[model samples]
Target: MLFEDPVFASRMLSLLTLSIHAIFATLGVGLPLMIIIAHWLGIKKNDEHYLLMARRWARGFVVLVAVGVVTGTAIALQLALLWPNFMEMAGHVIALPLFMEVFAFFFEAIFLGIYLYTWNRFDDQRKHLLLLIPVAIGATMSAFFITTVNGFMNAPTGFQIIGGQMTGVSPIEAMFNPATPTKAAHVISTAFMTSAFVLAALAAYRLLKGAQHVYYKKALHLMMVVGLIFAIATAVIGDFAGKYLAKHQPEKLAAAEWHFETMEGAPLVLFGILDDEQNVRFGLEIPYALSILAHNHPQAEVIGLNEFPQEWHPPLFIHYLFDLMVIIGVWLVLFSFVYWWGMRRKWTIVTSRWFRRLIVASGPLAMLAIQAGWWMTEFGRQPWILRGVMTVEEAATQSPYVGHLFFFFLALYLILVIGVVVVLRNINQRFPLEQDLAHEGGERPWIT
Candidate 1:
């Protein structure tokens, strides 16, 4: 029956598209900042390697941006087609932030083009670095606007819904809704951490293959340092996000924590398989830990799914995914500390083969954590598309052909994923080694 529902089909398709799009989206938000940093460092140290690394990173960023544009356009179209009713009602409020996002995208694109093109043309390093400031700001602003819109969906404000229609719309207020701060901060911090780990993983892979180039070493060091800082920051922000959810979306938080009965001093479920009876069949729980984490007191009251109607409960599986995300976050935080400790002690860990392997492994793990975190967020907001405003069944298109469309888009995404991998691999292979650069008589290599 679920599979027969067009609403379910539409939701699945949207989730698939978002998951695929998020990889590039995070990178788009983050890689530009890293490039800017690399460029700035290059200028400060007169290091051609940092500059070259920045240029190469820019090429990858461009490819991802192109793909992001396609996926982003598809998402926009899906919103209109699949959720026309929701769009018609709240389009005005949503459009405000999205329109701002478009400007941000254009600003990023313009500065990115200028920065990439003027690499060889600009003899002045300061001017070249200055161009990247807008690129970083624009990219971050783009994410901020988009996340603000999503935040509005989670915690809508600035409008009254009377007689099934939105009225008294104040787009500015909606843009700065209660949920925006925590949501935007969490997303932006994860973007930077994800991008840093990706670059660090690449450097580790090269080092593992016996590449002793200073470029790889420096890249690894820089990316890991950035990654560690953001990774730690994300953990702290994640706590604030949890507190926000506890206060604003207690039911969703309950499902995520697997609190089957409302109680004080709730234990934090670590791993669990929930049954149809609303019971966690098997799991580990840290007694009183969730209450302390969520409310800073062991005896603090924590709501449960049973407090709401059965139909209103978010999917229980979100608990597992949420736990997985937290586990990965903890691992990354610990790894970052170890890496930092080694760096302070003259970088002794770089010589360890096991550490290099772990670094190589962290890339996919970071990606997994990012995806899992999103899964917890989106899926935890189940039964409602706009949280207390409209249900997914009300928002989804009535057309029965959505299932076919889902399959089509799934296939399309598969092709796009393969194409991206192939293109990026070829680009990586084409990058000139440090030895090649040394023999080139100081000629700046062109990325194109």
Candidate 2:
């Protein structure tokens, strides 16, 4: 017989899977653009070092893609088994994107194989680079379609729930819901930003370990530029996301800001602890900042938690997730900006051992920020699996097996992580940077 109290177990299992899957999925979405650019640069400059960077990144990306596919499949299964009610209802109005995502995944997979194996088949490296265009497109589209489903959950438009049945369904409207553009853009931009920093961290570590090479410098510089561009885009889109919350999901916005009273000229709370009584403690209070962020006007009215029932309020701790994401976004902007400027000024500080340590640290921090942002989004929508439509309790599976399944998947993720580390370490050992450089003047078997 199925257990009735499986909501918590199911929720935890899904959270664990998504969190682990995030690492590989983020790279799958972002690494292709970088690979294509690096390959293009290699061809343009006729530089063996750049070619080596592209080849190395591509090989590692293949491993990530494999693991990502496995975890992605796990997510797919969990959606049907764990949230059958939500899917059954959503399948009527929001199934288009979910169906399209499968095609997108295959498109990406097909081109990735072609790109990987045909590295040296064409005389023109540019022609080889051309194959990655489809790969990038497929990866980007996959993220786009999946995010649209998330967007629909947030907005829940395109259909009417009449007598507990969906009516007036329009899949197109659900796909083009108000939340899709900002959410999709933000997800893509941050994925690119996080991936760049992770790769840049590798280069920084190389330099820190006394690996004296111009290749690391070039690699770091390229990633810094890419990181800077996308980081700025993330901030801009994040602002739009704020505006979206204020207009469409005011309760979530209110909870994230610790706004307890609905009023104009609201203050923004920064890094505060919520007391047992729900009061802000030790927070930096910026007068009218919340109003401005929500409505582009300092005097505009901002909603608050009091506007909804106590049960409707999301956890107050999510404010920390919101703050962490903002802080990290700003930090990366400053870090990448200063690095790029320092290079232009030819300052020794830019290449200092301590500075490289900071660079190595930034990569993990960027990913940490990504997790915080995603958590903030998911947690802010508390109680409701689809805002105003279905509660999590209503959507979660009644199966007792969820608890056991969580442990099983947790072990699977650990094994996958160990396998990836072993494979990547072996690849690095088998084809060291110095070894590749030594053979640059001769026939390059590494190309195959």
Candidate 3:
């Protein structure tokens, strides 16, 4: 029945677009901070290497932001075209944050252009680097506003709905809903971690290829430190997020852990296959772990999906996705610690063949973890687009052509992906390496 539904087709299309957009969006959010920091370091050390790295990275950041904008615009259009009913009803309530995000986007774009264009124009390094402050803030604020809007969707507050109509709107309350803090922190932290790992991974790859230049090594070290900190922070913040879910959306918590029966001392299902008979097949669960994790006590009661109607239960497959995210997160933490330990001992961990392989793999693993985390959050909220307010079916457009549009968008996304990859590869090839520029006395040829 789901396969035959146009709503399902539209939902899938929208999810596809969002997932692809998320890659660029996370980079867009994270790269600015790194760029600004690199510029600061350059100014502090009076080292041309750091400045060159920052400028080179900024060019790539510009490309990512440009692509992000296009994909982001596509998502906005999809929301209206695919789920008009939901947008029409709640648009006003969510509009404030969305509008703020647009302003943030514009702000980021304006400064980014100026920062990129004026790389060598200002002789004062401090003055040149100052432009990146607003660029970083604007990029981060864009993520904050958009994430708050999503948080509102999960928690749904600041308004009264009667007979399918909203009234007594409080934009401030909606913007800073109960879920805002945890969700915003988690999202932003992951962005930083993702970007750091990605950059580190690329640099590590080059290192393994015999490009053992100081510039690459420095970049790798900087990104690794930042990535490790955020990776550890994400795990801790994730626990807080879990607790929030247990209190606010117990059914989602149940589904996430695959707890089918309501009882005390709920075991945490680590890996399981849920079946039609409400049993976990070939499952591995830790006794009382769910209770302790959710409420910090082994005896605490954890609600289960059976307590809610069949339609209210979230998809069970999200359990595996949640598990995958946790597993990868733990791996990142351990890997970071090992890398740090090696660094402390003055070991050439970055050049080690096996370690380099792991480092290169870290980027894709982090990306997967971020995607999985989102899958759990979005899919775990399933059947309802606005939590208790509206079912996805109620919000989805009633159009027979959605399936066709889905294919069209799929093709378009493929093209966008190819274009981005080619463009980024070209940029990397054209950009001068630190060794290449050292002979020129640290002068950048690209800067006019």
Candidate 4:
């Protein structure tokens, strides 16, 4: 038996469940925003292909968003039960944000339901276009509100703990936590980026297969443009976030870089083995990279993980996660830029087999990057539910039956995973071949 500490095991399980839950979250929060935007454009251009794609995407969004809501509700309840101390402290500190999140959720649900049902209700183009605005607005608000909760967790503002009881909580401080703006921008932009790439991948895959459809080509091109622009923009914002963390959370930056010395001109580790006792990543190095990244000066002193106590340091596993995210992010930017350039040059992308294969691969690559980035954030914040305020051990539920809780969450998520796959497959089947459409009798000329 591993004989892990109960608190540690609980934290691990919490991370696992939350991570799985959030995969649906990005899709839920992001897909709807893009769908509404595409739908609006479709209406404006009076383009049937755009309208068809939007309707198709909306259906998938409806199913996945429903699952996301359910899973998110579970996570919320689990948070309170799994860490009562954390709930007590954070509930008081960030109550306003949590309350506001409820409103955002309600807004999203209402607008999404309307969009799903009233596809043909509004004959007037302008009024129908107006419907998409609420959907986009709701999605954006939902994403921002959720990030407010996470930002509070990271910066832990809005309240003080006196003798273990929260006191003098301030809603404004919680909403405007130090991490609020940065984390919100980072998360929302990345969501947009992910949605774009995923859409592009699907469209490109069909186009490359010689589907002989105009719908797929136009959709892929637009999606490619959106994905490329946002992916690059997200990277720029992430760089700013990296600098902000270096200034405010040096330990996290150090752990991410696997730096072992607090010194000038620290070389970043491209790949190395961590010698925990010696407190260094041995073998390989990239000269002066850490110094440049941290301080914009090659000789500027950059702190290292070794400066912190062993118990306090984030695990090496999270360092690898952070690295994977960065590496994949770079690849996405490069690939997206090239793909967009090809589109500008008159859609050479569809004709190139190799490029088409790469496009199909881009969806999974971007998804992997998003997952790794989140792991870096949550896992990198180790031992602290609220950074510097409360340790994970202090906040963990005292019950030893956490194993049972873990299995329950595990089983629930497993069902959700199966449901998502089945639903997506059914949605995919909705977009049929022209031959299939012909076979269905020309009565229903519309693809739907």
Candidate 5:
């Protein structure tokens, strides 16, 4: 068990790195894309307010992206140090995407810098707007490459073991591996979904406080539209992604569905306690829904956790994560509908005290959705390091010092969190958007 102790430590280290990485991932993908889209619209319509909004958001995004890059680099380095066997075996297959991710990072930084400093240096509006294309593309490509690597992990491909050694690794095959496409699409959509909800929540807060300036209203409307669009898209794609997982990773689907055995026309446990020893759900159930969802048949049989030995069972913690994600997603969809309907009738919901309460709650809900979504992805794989080839324990750092990495990252993230709060406070204090625009700069471009 002493040797196995390091395995747990290694997992905790990776989780720390992953959790930090998730923050960056959310900001890196979500903030930049939103700003870029806003910037594009700004340039197209000659709307100075839109451009100003874009610049402010981009400034915040730049600061966050800097931290994101630092945390991401740390994660990549730790991956090699902690999972040497996994790296040595699968690194070659993922080399191309990893290399592309680096390029994406550099390219995004380059354009972002130029755009930050080149407003006066470049007189042509069209040329200036062109700079954003690369910035947007680079940010998106960075996320896409990382998602591809993650996807490959879920459904590995592009290599073989010959005489106990992985050989003939193919990058192309790995990029198009079994789970890569669907997983990438799912993650990409979730990023947008979480971002929209977060932005909407912020805008809703402002709207509720009677900050009815033109700029704030515009921002709120934009956020609402974005939230509605991404919410609907996420629902459709999530369904597709779920069906894909059901076909390929049935055990994971079973765990998420909370099914305890092979059963006919399984009742879906919407909210329940899994009695693993007794192999039954001990709470609320929706009759025959699981069978219909998983197999499109009312009486279709679904396998469950009891079919696998206790040692091989996926962690119950992970099953809870899956449930949390699904529940939050459904909540988002419902809230989005309410918001959209209220907006059509002149934002009656935002002015109401009850809606303001809900708006405040949505901030944490959005964050929980992001964390839960990732938890499901990483934890649902369960024992697999490569989904059919290796176990999590087998792929972990064999070294005793792995726990140090976890503590190091915990301290680092605490510092980063403090820094983020300080920066946000300073921005709000110095340039309070709720106040009159004349007090700031008389509609001139002011970067926060």
Candidate 6:
């Protein structure tokens, strides 16, 4: 990275920071809702399995929340430190949401601490369950507020530049930028989808390891149900994302589809290689798909990369990132459908060891899909750090220590990851299922 162009090195380091932070951020936002729902079900159904399930999830989440706090803090600082110029402008118009997110984070942290220690402290289960609502709301609002800043970047509104200063600022308008709803909803749904699958993967691994207990079965069922619901929601919101891009950020939509020429009925190119001749080679083209994606009409005229100068054009390689994201989304949908069908039909194949292993694999694959979507979004905005308002070169910090800072943060993230794994493993070992089962006076390690 030191040998690379300074601007390019800074961009790569920012990408690394965001990529790592996203892992915990995704879980942090999604898991609170899951935990609360699981707890609610435990009381409603009078089921001890769900009661233990929720408790276990909550215990593991404490560690993740701490990691999220550290990474979240690191990212907040990195924005100002690495992109001083952009932050300078943003501090005037978009600062409201950024500041609001801190309050939201504190809200979440306070309730989470209360929720953890107060577990099983209430005779009225509903009273204890009520405590989780703020935790869930705070987690979601934290993501929402932060995404508003990003939405402002994509479609910068409620402010203007005059005499090299941002003027006419309206923080509310900027916070609710055109891209905010779609992007925020998309982020949230995918986070839920990814988190569900990750927990499902853990349950599947347990089931595959010959733990045929009803506890594991119940856990797997809950995660899969949640995964399937959010998977569908993610797909629906993704379509809205396409429409949003086509209308406001058409160049991004065009590049993702590899549509080079502006025309009606433009075919959507999937998995294509671009040649110097401006032709896409050896990839599938779904006729009129791009037009339909853009306008919900097959004959709608869609914008294309040809409309923009080559220098202004985003790198064509982001098309693959777009493709990877879509392909993984489709895979999760279909894979979940099969799991649903097999469960209904009582198919032995779905219960086979290989099928359970597939469930385990889906967890990481879902996370990768998330990574792909984010990369495509950031890369597609290339040349511009804030769309048309600012370029990356202008926004990057001129600090001489960017390389050193990158290494320090990189080492910190590595240590944090190792700590999370070791701590979670220890938690799991310390609170084995037999301890939970002992309270119920049920057969310990009983097979279903």
Candidate that scores best on lDDT: 2
Pairs in steric clash, model 2: none
Lowest-sum lDDT 10-residue window in model 6: 439-448
The candidate that wins on TM-score is 2
What's every prediction's RMSD, in angstroms?
Answer: 1.8, 1.8, 1.8, 3.0, 2.8, 2.9
Worst 10 residues of 2 by lDDT: 1-10
What are the models' TM-scores?
0.96, 0.97, 0.96, 0.91, 0.91, 0.96
Q: What is each predicted model's overall lDDT from 0 to 1?
A: 0.88, 0.90, 0.88, 0.76, 0.75, 0.87
Q: Give the RMSD in angstroms, all C-alphas superposed, for model 5.
A: 2.8
Error of 4 at 151 (Å): 1.7
For candidate 1, lDDT tens digit of each residue in 1-448? 5656888899999999999989999999999989988888887898878877787788889999989988988999999998988898889899989999999999999988888888678778888889989988998998999999889888999999889889999999999998899999999999999999999999999999999888898999899999999999999999899888888888888989989788999999889677767677578979998898778899998887788997788987888889988999999989977897887887866558899899998888988998999899888888888999998888889998888899899999999999999999988777657544664336666655
lDDT of 6 at 22: 90
Q: Cα lDDT for residue 268, model 3?
A: 90
lDDT of 3 at 357: 84
Q: How big is the positional error of residue 152 in model 3, measured in Å on the Cα after superposition? A: 1.5
- Candidate 5 or 1, higher TM-score: 1
Tens digit per residue, CA lDDT, model 5, 320-374: 7766777877787788778778878887755576875686576568678778878
| Model 2 regions lying over 4 Å from their true place | 1-4
Candidate 3 lDDT: 0.88
Residue-level lDDT tens digits of model 4 in 1-448: 2214568657767777777767777877678767766777877897766766776787778777788888778778878877888887777666677777778878878876776667556667567657667776777787798888887777777777789787888888888888888788988888888888888888878877777687777777788778878888888888777776777777888877877679998887755666737455454577987888787888989987778887768766777777777777788888878877766676765458788778788887878888888888877787688889888878888777777777777898898889889978976776564543353323333224
What's model 1's lDDT at 294? 78
Off by over 4 Å in 5: 1-4, 43-46, 121-126, 207-212, 296-300, 309-311, 434-436, 439-448
- The C-alpha stretches of model 4 lying farther than 4 A from their native spots are 1-5, 208-210, 276-284, 346-350, 430-448
